[model samples]
Target: MTDDDPISLPAHDWPEFPPGLVWLVGAGPGEPGLLTLQGLHALRAADVIVHDALVDGRILEWRRADTQLEYAGKRGGKPSARQRDISHRLIELSRDGQRVLRLKGGDPFVFGRGGEEAQTLVQAGVPIRVTPGISAGIGGLAYAGIPVTHRDVNQAVTFLTGHDQTGLTPAALDWPALARGSQVLVMYMAMKHLPKIADALLAAGRRPDEPLAIVSNATLPGMRVLETTLGTASHDAEAQSMEAPAIVCLGRVVLMRQAIDWMSQLQGNPPRNPDPLGGGARTTG
Candidate 1:
């Protein structure tokens, strides 16, 4: 193919996606374009795809015409397949000599239960391969014009799940240690327990006025971002009725959105806060 044509590697260069093998792939954070080349390859080659709720439909369009698509998604408060059932299904599909592709949203290892699934697959003696995709906490935040870290703002950032299997804020997390250790905190599945989390953080000595932003439907065309403070995050979210499948960022790096909201600039709008750092000049941090 010419330079203008789509890049297509020789078949020999691509990894073998054989029948009876299961591939666990990350679909990225809501954006079809964010899917990795390996993931795309598996999508096109698999005989059947088992996907979660966050896997974008556009990405699935790349699958082979005869490929079977299965919805194994788990949405909060919705009727969803249990994790055990999903894993067992993969094992069964492989044993049936199917090229099974288990597509998850974001990096499979990052709070995606991919490890648990992988373990189950291994225990069942199923051969598997993995392809990681950009996590929502990072890519989603970037789409919202918020940086996870900046030298002038924070030296370290922490990513954590907001709740455990019981649907409550993770009690095992050391609130005080987290508050004192990380300069930036990116939370997943936090909307449900945001109020309790905020309370724990406040009790742990985090500043109430710290900057916080909730990015919903991140990286999607309909993405929405709400800029608020730690003190009033719950109240503001409640007032706006913020939805799930969102990434919550808590740190000074959130202020960077004021200067580099590329999404707004892409629409020909200038930065709202030309001087977010309060010194009358623009800076990335």
Candidate 2:
């Protein structure tokens, strides 16, 4: 096999990608290798792929040369296609006997609006297949050596979008409840309103010095992880020019990154701290 050739997988037990069916596949974080086997199969078999803004371009290289690629990504503060129109186009394409693939970043159901699209397809009597992918809230954090749930840290985790349809902080969220209820909070697209979110959490009794980590371009070559406190997250991100397409993790688990940053270990750089919890020093044999 050559470098340009598409990575192949065993076809055994794989479902056939028939015409007039829409497959909603998650592309995982930003790493092409993270694409699920089912997702890759859909990519190769689909006649057209309607992908989101976060789907990495490298993953598209696996699709057949003749497959049609459509952009229906919706980014904050940008001019983008309407959700209804995008769903309508999917129905139109499938009705035209094309194998339609809706590729989204992370799990489609996790703040990716895959549920809405699935509902639209079902209501329109369109056949569809759903493929779940690793969410950024979990997988992205893992890439940064931050676990969403830790036995010693958090027993519960909450995942929420930073904004609602109006492009503002979700007003319906009970800030006090979230502050006290969830042990760890994973926020998506929260960079735009980080300061406001921090203020709300602080007002709700969350500690100002609560540990937080912002992971940018997660699982990709340019991935960056910033460790800061809840009070300083907004200002620190701005001072460092942290960009979007990032994941924000808030809780004690953020401290665990100091001990288990395995990616750095691969390059002969040991973790900065071996005992993040301060239980005792861990010895390397």
Candidate 3:
């Protein structure tokens, strides 16, 4: 149990990573420690690494000295590589008998466009492996001390994106239905359209004073959490000059952050449980 050992599982028991296959791996939400053992193994064996914008650069250090690094990052309003081109590059690399690793930030299936790439690989008749990572919706919220679901607060949670292909608030989303059906909402890439999104939520009967928290640069050193109401979230975020790559969380669970912000607690602050929901009398599971 030395500190050098990252995992307790026996290394010899891990499965072999065959060549001429593309491995779609979730790099986790900005923390190197959060990367899975399978992901680390893939990095160590990958002949070519194709990474996204949100992935921390430190993770690339795990690759072999001869491993080729390729950037396929796509950021909002920034010039970047097209999705199709990246997919083609992956297929080409694997077809050349190279072990390709498509590394992404957070769970690849959760808004990471991993599905699109995987489909392309399948159509190309290339062997592929998928490794799940901790999505920002869950992992980022935890880092901010906001639970996605709590028995006393919400039994259900919904995850959505802030924008669609057209680069606007997703027109396909049924805002009113979402507002009525979901108890908690976790949105990705919503910062740019927060104003319109907030308006829709409010129009759909969501309270103006409903608690919400925006976690930016989640799990990294520069991470910032802005706690505000649905009504003021957009404006408040702008006032603070917050940037993108954030998770927008809305629900009563935001209150729990006051008492469970372990990151803050580590800095000498204590938990503050005001019991806004009046469920303090119940025992915690």
lDDT of 3 by residue, 214-265 (tens): 9999999999999999999989999998899999999999988988899999
lDDT by residue (1-285, candidate 1, tens digit) is 122433464565778999999999999999998998888888878999999999988888878777899999998879999999999999999999999999999999999999999999999999999999999999999999998987677899999999899878898999999999999999999999999999999999999999999999999988999999999999999999899989999999999899989999999999998668775553555
Query: Which of candidates 2 and 3 is the stronger one according to TM-score?
Result: 2
What lDDT would candidate 3 get against the real structure? Answer: 0.92
Give the whole-model CA lDDT for all candidates, comma-separated: 0.92, 0.93, 0.92
Candidate 3: where is the Cα deviation over 4 Å? 1-9, 274-276
lDDT of 2 by residue, 1-285 (tens): 223576678857888888999999999999998999989988988899999999999999888888899999998888998999999999999999999999999999999999999999999999999999999999999999998987777789999989999999999999999999998999999999999999999999999899999999999999999999999999999999999989999999899999989999999998899889887653554
**Model 2 misplaced regions, further than 4 Å:** 1-6, 280-285
TM-score head-to-head 1 vs 2, winner: 2
List the pairs of residues colliding in candidate 3: none
| Candidate 3: count of backbone clashes, pairs at least 3 residues apart or interchain | 0
Which stretch of 10 consecutive residues in model 3 shows the poorest summed lDDT? 1-10
Top-lDDT structure, candidate number: 2
Candidate 2 lDDT trough over 10 residues, lowest sum:
1-10
* Candidate closest to the true structure, highest TM-score: 2
Model 2, position 176, has a per-residue lDDT of 98
